[model samples]
Target: MISASAAVLRAGDRPYAIEEVILDEPGADQIVVQVAATGFCHSDAVARAPKFVQVWPLITGHEAAGVVERVGSEVSGIEVGDHVVLTFAYCGTCSQCADNHPAYCETFVQRNILGLLATGGARATAAGDESVGARWFGQSTFATRTVVDARSAVVVDRDLPLDVLAPLGCGIITGAGTVLNVLDVRPGTSVAIFGVGSVGLAALLAAKAAGAESIIAVDLHPARLELATELGATATILGGDNDSVAEQIRKLTNQGTHYSIDTTGVPEVILCALGSMRARGVCASVGIQTGDVVLDGHALSGKQLVSVIEGDADPRTLIPHLIQLWRDGRFPFDRMLERFPFTAINEAEKASLEGRAVKPVLVMS
Candidate 1:
């Protein structure tokens, strides 16, 4: 067993508290990771709401990167001391996984969100021997150390900075993958992105890398808009302005964008994303919906609306491609990262909620 300090969220409405936890040995298909850092995602915030809290005394963090401390007896291709990024869990034998769509794996919700272990046991326990939901997204990386299925670990170059690369596991992949993998955004095409937060900005950066001809970014925050402008957005629209945002994008792109992406789940913003696209253009929705989305039948007359999960990305392939782009100075996702100490997890979460930081990473001490 291993002992580590973790941020424990005992209730849906309470703040995370620092506590010493006990970790069980890795299973035959699992590995132990000494987490260097974990990225804060909006989904983590969503999990704190009353309705979403299925497991009490949970340690919820999805995006993480670290060095492998131990490899299970049956683990292969991955060894102790390898650098890896922890992503969502998947059952390798499932049809979806066999088809390279692990994001849609049959047991996705069970393994990733419900915090169920394949072995039907808890990977971690609190001081009183109470089981904690430590398998969140298969990594539960809010802690300094975690035991995770080998299928969830993506090996990366040892030289890369784990803190900066942590977001690649989910948010970054969802954004960039929507453009590169799902949309197949080609050069000389126009695109529009709604809600320029970390995910939207990542999409913007991917669009730029894909050689998009015109990129329009729409957001409610002027500060984020300015950052978008700096990060290669050809045009920016104030989200709720009296002017029609879709029309503005249409005017900028000589009719409408060939593609659009909505990172904000707001119903109105989604409508604008649909309206901003040209005939037959596709729009990918990657955000968590807060309320029901009531769509007009006419909205689908000539366009397509796709609900993308994890950007339809195969992480093993996409992450390396993104890393190469970063090395070539093409995909600079680092600009969106803000590092915080693991002990200041509550502070980091507050910053993320307040928009004081784009991507808050918790670095283990």
Candidate 2:
């Protein structure tokens, strides 16, 4: 057993607390990871919200990069001391996995989101045998140490810094993959991204890399618009002024954008993106929508609306490609990161929610 500090959500609507927890050694096909850095994503907040009561007493985190401390006897092609990123866990035997789409694996609900242990047991026990859940996203990365399935751990280049690569597992992949894989954005195509957060910005960068001639970024924050321009957005739309946001995009794109993505998840913003798409144009929804999203069936049918999960990417392939783009200075996603110590996770989450931080990473010592 090993003692580790974890930021745990004991119950819904309660703040996360740093607690000393016990971590068991790796079991078959499992590996123990010493988390170096973890990204504080909005999904974590969503999971902690009262509406999501699926998982409790859980360690909340998903986007993480770390070093492998030990590998289980049954694990292969991995070793101790390997640098890795813990992405969504998948059962390799699932139909989705067989089709090269692990993100859509049927077992994702149990293997990653629900914090079920490798042996289908609980990860923690409080005083007098109370249960404390771990294995969130198959890594429980908010903790200093987490046991993860071999399939959940993707070995990355050791030369890349964990602080830089951590968010690539989710936000970056979701954004870029939506453009490259789901949308299949082509050269000279026009693209518009609604809600220029980390995910939206990543999509803008990918669109630019794909040789998109006109890339428009929409957001209420002017600062984010400035950053989007730096990252290769050809145009910007102030979201607050909806009077001509769609008109401006139409003007810029000649008719309307060939592809549109909504990362805001707001009903209005989604509608705006759909409205801004050309006839039969593809519009991908990559945002997290909580309440019911109302839309006109005619509008959606005319626009070919679609929802993308994890950008419809195969992480093992997409992440490395993104890292290579980063190395080439074409995809500078690291610019979005604002580092903080693990103790300040709550503050970081607040900053991210308030738009003060594009991507906040918690560094563990």
Residues 45-134 of candidate 2 have per-residue lDDT tens digits of 878666463656788888999999888888998999999988887888879999989888888777766655356434865446656677
Quote the positional error of residue 154 for candidate 2 in Å: 1.1
Alpha-carbon shift of residue 15 in model 2 (angstroms):
2.6
User: What C-alpha RMSD separates each model from the true structure?
Assistant: 1.3, 1.8
- TM per candidate: 0.97, 0.95
In candidate 1, what are the lDDT values of residues 1-365, reduced to their tens digit?
77878898888889999899998777888888999999999999888887675778899899999999988888998999999998988888799999999999989888888876454335678987888888788778899998888878899988899998999999999999999989999999999999888999999999999999899999888889999999999999998952388888888898789999999888778888988888999999999866777777777669998989998888888989999999999999999899999999999999998888889999997
lDDT assessment of candidate 1: 0.88
Segments in model 1 whose C-alpha atoms lie over 4 Å from true places: 241-243
The residue pairs found clashing in candidate 2 are none
